[model samples]
Target: MFATVAFAQANDDLTINTPPSIVQCKTTMISWDGGVSPFDLVRISISLSMHNTETPNLLLSINLRAKCSVTEEGVVVEDFPNILPGSSFDFFVDFPAGATLGFTVTDNNGDKAETAPVTVQESDESTCLSD
Candidate 1:
């Protein structure tokens, strides 16, 4: 008897490399790798929940509004660019006080990868001063 092996190819192999940590009313740097389609648009979704707010179920697991386009000669063009393999993008997100945030990145091919859910802790620092 003989055995054979097969290797499968991935249409989209996007991966999120951001570590899982508690976000405490601060900006968190999110990064990823192994995505394709420079011409494809990148969509980022963040699930947020309020912890210190009086309002209930506010801003919970909502898709963040953002814009993406291609670049030409170091200038961003109003078109989708083809993202090469092994390329990466960085997203900076600010977590307001009393909010918990988790996020994921979707490639142009409709494939997505996410970081482990990170809970946002209430910070002692005030985002604004009360009058």
Candidate 2:
């Protein structure tokens, strides 16, 4: 299995450091200001606008994962703008290392079918967009 791993600078904006697998979009990576954050959980939300399509309720999924995501540490919280199905992007959060980055989808405008958040690495080389 092939995977891509990237590191973000301290108090840096990771959106500019887009990897080869990640497509540049409006996906905002809200990182740390210095040390810790005032909030506990770093929430990730998506804003998708689907137009005339065969399946209006077609579910498109994405797995946002990082090495340093923590509830108390205030890892990373990002907002995806105008995201569509099958489009690849990345979310950068201020995490340490070897920590579990669990993302809970909040205010899901796309009506994602996943009841739970998924942590996926860049491993899929195929797309099921034709269905």
TM-scores, each model vs. reference: 0.46, 0.23
Poorly placed runs, candidate 2 (over 4 Å): 1-76, 104-109, 113-131
Estimate every model's Cα lDDT from 0 to 1: 0.44, 0.27
Query: Candidate 1 has which clashing residue pairs, if any?
Result: 37-83, 38-81, 38-82, 38-83, 39-81, 39-82
Count of backbone collisions in candidate 1? 6
On lDDT, the candidate that comes out on top is 1
Model 1: weakest 10-residue lDDT segment is: 71-80
lDDT of 1 by residue, 1-131 (tens): 12222112234477776545544534545566655444233322233333444433333222323443322221211222354543454333345543334445567667766666555555675453122
Q: For each candidate, C-alpha RMSD in Å?
A: 10.1, 17.0
Model 1 spans > 4 angstroms off: 1-12, 39-93, 128-131
Residue-by-residue lDDT tens digits, candidate 2, 34-74:
11112222343222122433221222333244222222232
